[model samples]
Target: MKKRSFADLFFLLFVVYIVLPVVATMLYAFAGKWNKTILPEGWTLKWLATLFQDTAFIQAFGRSVLLSGGAVIIALLAIVPAIFVIVLYFPKYEKWIQAAVVMVYSFPGVILAVGLIRVYSQFGVPMIVVVLGAYVIGILPYIYQGTRNSLRNVDARQLLDAAQLLGASKMQAFRKVLLPTVYPGLFAGALLSFSVLFGEFVLINLVVGSRFETVQIYLMKKLSTSGHIASAVVFIYIVLMGILTFIIAKLTKQAKGATNV
Candidate 1:
């Protein structure tokens, strides 16, 4: 048998750290009645059925999807073009822009939520507007960093020259050449932000008010009212997120392959 290296050991530990909570949650979710006892009494699908039957859970799930989709679309539309412009035309300011984006990322979610609430209350903006704003601010840093890295890796000069050589317009070059290169990174950023946003509660709670319950908010409610139901909701949430992550991972992988070819 071969001996494991320190890196391998660390990697194994990291995997365990990631999976432990998920594994425990899955077990509890299946257990019909897991209490303060050492182990669950038995396993059943009752929790899953109860979870699906809840109308509020279904609505919250839809809202999360709508909010996340809107945020990602808006972020990409604004961020991608802006990053491209900065990298292509004003390379000198790349460092400064990157620094600013990093600083934006450092803004705590709760604090940002609080600020948004004050602004919204004064302006008479609806709760949905505030929720969308929070989503955009929260995910901007991820999108920015991903795009910046993608731009760094791609050769802007080559793209420009190719376009000119082929008699393609600037817009064509940007659309065809530049976009293809950076899409994988951008997709990755969007996916990461989506994963985080799906489960996000702090900002949404503060900005939209507790009356508007998202999936996470619903889970919080269940923890007190019905822990078994909460566990079930969490299990479903994990499955949903895992599926999303898997799709994004596949998309990113395909994007990388296309870029390579």
Candidate 2:
């Protein structure tokens, strides 16, 4: 009974810690003028209206979408097939793939930005292109995990062999049979990767700041100019992340249900 009480109290504190800032930020966005009191003196949608009216914010948001969406597509095209081959045929090579995924965690945003700049800067390619490439590699873990997990439940080898025995080519077998079976897990991974890249600020800012302003870069600029606007930006970002998280949960649950069958 005592332990349960302590646990409940601990969780209440944790909830407050996590939720207080978000609530405050949301309040500030709608706040006409909040100063020194428990709540805003007045509330208005002026900040949100002002934010939407900004052309720079719209462009920055688009750039973020392009960068993140492009990376996820490129990763899907490149990594998904490789992982499918690895998991279905050469399971021995999976350890190597796992090692590469582990190495991705070792490179933080700062280190990753610096490393990519060093290697690619000399080649005279566009910095944004370089950033896009890094984004693909950055999301490998998600792509690998999702694809690999989806493939794990099914007897992929036997399924493929049976498909081939029925006079289908390997490519045909993969496209028709394997791809559909593992799609939920793959979709989950893709969404996870997109959400992660969408919020990425460090690498892009460091690589090409003013030259290519993402939503994150725009938010940084707003920080010095207006607290209300910044709060609106953060609130929007949090809401977006929450939405993605919900979708990812639903997809993951669906994948598990499929696996059980």
Candidate 3:
């Protein structure tokens, strides 16, 4: 009884700590005036309305979506197959792949941005391309883990061998048998990657700045203008992330179900 009471108290405190700020921010986004009050003085949607009406915000939102989606697509097309081949045919090289994934996080974003600028700017390469490449590499850990976990959950070797024995070529076996098994996990990873890159600021700011304003860049600009608008941006960002998280959870559950079957 005592332990249960303690657990309840702890859970309440945890919820308050994490949720209070978010709740306050949401209120402020629609609040007419919230100063010195536990409750908002009045509510209005002008902040959100203004945010949507801003062409810059809309463009930045689109750029963020495109950049994140493009990176995930590229990663899925390139990294997934490479990992699949390495896992099935060249198990010994998996260690090298793991090392590379770890290296994704080894360098700070600022350092990476500076190095990319030095190497690519000298050749007159487009800064957008450089940032896109970095975004792809930045998502390696999420994609690699999702793909690796999915592969591990099934007897990939046996499935591939069985498919081959049934007169399927290697490529056919992989495409028809293995890919479907891992699709849910890959999709989840892609969504996760998109969510991460959507909010990325430091690398994009240093590498491209206003040349390619993402949602985060736009949010930074809004902070000095009005607190309400900034709070609206945060609320919208939170909603976007929440939707992606819901999809990821659903996909993960479906993946587990498919693996079990």
Candidate 1 ranges with C-alpha deviation above 4 Å: 1-18, 35-39
What C-alpha lDDT, on a 0 to 100 scale, does residue 10 get in candidate 2?
A: 100
Name the lDDT value of residue 24 in candidate 1. 81
Compared with the true structure, all predictions reach lDDT values of: 0.80, 0.92, 0.94
Cα lDDT for residue 221, candidate 2:
98
Who is ahead in TM-score, 1 or 3?
3
lDDT of 1 by residue, 1-261 (tens): 135687788899999999988788888888876668777888898888988888998998888888888888898888678777887888898797778778777888788877777878887888787788767766877888778766666676687778879998888888888777777778888888888888888888777756677888888888999767888998988888888788778867766666563
Ranking by TM-score: 2, 3, 1
Using lDDT, give the best candidate's number: 3
lDDT of 2 by residue, 51-162 (tens): 9999998899899989999999999999999998888778999999999999999989998889888999899989999999999999999999999888887877888999
Candidate number with the higher lDDT (1 or 3): 3
Q: Could you tell me the lDDT of residue 201 within candidate 1?
A: 85
lDDT for model 1, on a 0 to 1 scale? 0.80
Write one digit per residue (lDDT tens) for candidate 3, span 1-261: 999999999999999999999999888899997888889989999999999999999999999999999999999999888999899889999999899988998999999999999999989989999999999999999999999989988999999999999999999998999999988988998899999999999999999999999999999999999989999999999999999999999999999999995
**Model 3 lDDT vs. the true structure?**
0.94
| Candidate 2 off by > 4 Å | none
True-structure RMSD, every candidate = 3.1, 1.4, 1.5
